[model samples]
Target: MTEFLDALVAHAFLQKALIAGLLASIGCGLIGPFVVVKRIAFMAGGIAHAVLGGMGAALYFGFDPLAGALVAALVSAILMGMVHLVWQAQEDTLISALWAVGMAIGILFIAKTPGYQADLMSLLFGNILLVPDRALVWMIALDLVLALTIAACYRPFLALAFDAEFARLRGLPVTVFYLLLLCLVALTVVLLIQVVGLILVIALLTLPAATAGHYVRSLGTMILIATLLGAFFTTLGLALSFGPDLPAGPTMILLAAAAYILSASLSHGLKQRRARLQIRDG
Candidate 1:
């Protein structure tokens, strides 16, 4: 651990990885709980996978892949949101179709691209150490945007998450807010792609939030706690990965999964113990 900390000061890639990881944590922390609470994890997954179509198109046409991914993600988010809202029965089926279609489009485009094709593993599984300085700047800018948006619309989002019909009754534009939330989800998926890639992005987004949810009652509190937990997990996972020469994405996710299991088990034990005590007293 001490060696890793010292290496961070000496290594540029390590520093960049650390910065990118933390920035991604901030975005994931803010958006993750909303995803879990609103039960939109599947929708978010669809959008994340759907970004691949844009990626493939970009590769085929010699354009920026991230830009392509961002556009694709937003389009997918909007499509999924509309499908979910307008035709509730067909929502799952449509999202599944979009998920498959996006991957198919990406594969087709990539196959058509000329020359030595770049390795797709990094885009699929992620290599945070390869994050460029420009990408870090983009992540920071995204963090700012997310922070402002959440601050401005926290209450309405909270209401929508808990009870959309009631929020609508209270004059909130439920459909608009719902769509806006999906857009944010799209942005978050894009932000996290550089760190965890499209394949495992949802796990990185959800695990910390799920762990934090065990202890926190309020949504805001869960976000704050999840953010911290995410940073810790990523930093620790990065350090551990350095020793074993492991993939950061899977390593970080494993650490987070461990934490979630620990938190859930501990919480369940405490609840059971308290129940037993109460019963004995009675």
Candidate 2:
């Protein structure tokens, strides 16, 4: 721990990595609750994996990979939103197809690209230490966009998440809000890619929020708790991995998974105890 702190003070890369993680946590905290409540993790995962196709194509065409990811994420989210709206019965099948096709396209593009493709593995798994200054600026911009959008649409989004039919009856544009929510999810997925990469992004996105949900009944409180948990997990994982030279992305995910498990178990146990006491009292 001491060595980690000393090195943290000495390394600019470590500072950038820490800042990136915290910034990523903001998006995760904000979007993750909606994901958990709406049961849209699968859709979000599809959008996330689909980003690699954009990234790979961007590399091949000599464009910014992040730009490619943004485009792909938005497109996938929109398509998925439409499918959910029109073909609810076949939603999962279409999403799964998108997920597989996106990954395959990305792999093919990467394979055909000339040279070593040194950064490919990092994009797949993630290396937070490699986050550059420019990326941090982009993260900050994206975070602000997310915060403002959520602030403006909070009530509508809350209505969309729980009881969409009711929202529709209340004269809310449920379809527009629903699509908008998915677009936000797409953006959040892109933001998280830097912290945990494409493959493990879903775990980090959902786990912290899910853990928070175990304790909180209010959506607002859940987001607050999830955001804090995400910050703690990412920062501690980075520090712990620094000492052992472990892979930072996987380390952070493992920590989050463990936390979710512990929280779930405790919540379950408490529920059971409450039930038993109620029975005894009766």
Candidate 3:
């Protein structure tokens, strides 16, 4: 294990990947509590896919893909948030349509581009082996912003998540807060596109938070557990990718899923044992 760690650090890419994972873990851990409680998984997924259009525009116009993706994601988020104000049938349907359109736009652009030889595998899944010091710095800045956002909006977000009625009754500007959450999530989705790509971004956002909620008694505890789990899974996926020849994004999702399964099994076993103990006592 020590030899492997040393080897990973020796390579600049692996080192940067690991560092970015840690930095991302911090933000995800902090913001994830609200994400889970608010039931915004689908919204997050929508934003993740919708970034494809921005990616297409960026590539077509001769700019960085990341810049384009960020633009696309932010726009998608605002559009999705507007769904509630527009009094639509269901926000879900609108989000689904938006997501498909974004994907279609991306495909169209990719098809039209001449001599397009991008390693689709890396962008579709993830290529941790490509993480660099520059990406690391950007990730750190993202985390810092997230930390501040959470610190400032904790109460408003918490109220909005568990009980919007109560928050609105308290004059909490529920609409503004809700939009802010989605916008932040969209930003997170954009950043994660580089780490895990659009395919598995939703999993990264939800799995740790979901799994952590099982054992943790308090919201704060749950966030800590989720953050730790996210970091662990990220590292485990990187290690697993060293073999299996699998892409980092899918591997990370698999690792997170495995953790969720483990947590569920343990919870089930404990429940069963408690039932047995009650029977014996009676």
The TM-score leader among the candidates is 2
lDDT per residue for candidate 2 within 1-282, as digits (tens), equals 999899999999999999999999999999999999999999999999999999999888888888999999999999999999999999999999998888888888888889727888898888899998888888998899999999999999999998999999999999999999999999999999998999999998899999999999899998999999999999999999999999999999999999999999999999999999999998
Clashing pairs in 2: none
Distance from true location, Cα of 230 in model 2, Å: 0.3
Residue-by-residue lDDT tens digits, candidate 1, 1-282? 788888999999999999999999999999999998998999999999999999999989998888889899999999999899898999889999999899889888888987515657887888899998888988998889888999999999999999999999999999999999999999999999999899999998899999999888899999999999989988888999987789998899999999999999999998999999999998
Evaluated against the true structure, the overall lDDT of model 2 is: 0.93
Worst 10 residues of 3 by lDDT: 114-123
Model 1 clashing residue pairs (backbone): none
Q: Give the TM-scores of the predictions, in the order they appear.
A: 0.97, 0.98, 0.92
Clash pairs, model 3 backbone: none
Residue 26 in candidate 3, Cα distance off native in Å:
1.9
lDDT of 1: 0.91
lDDT of 1 at 29: 96
TM-score of 2: 0.98
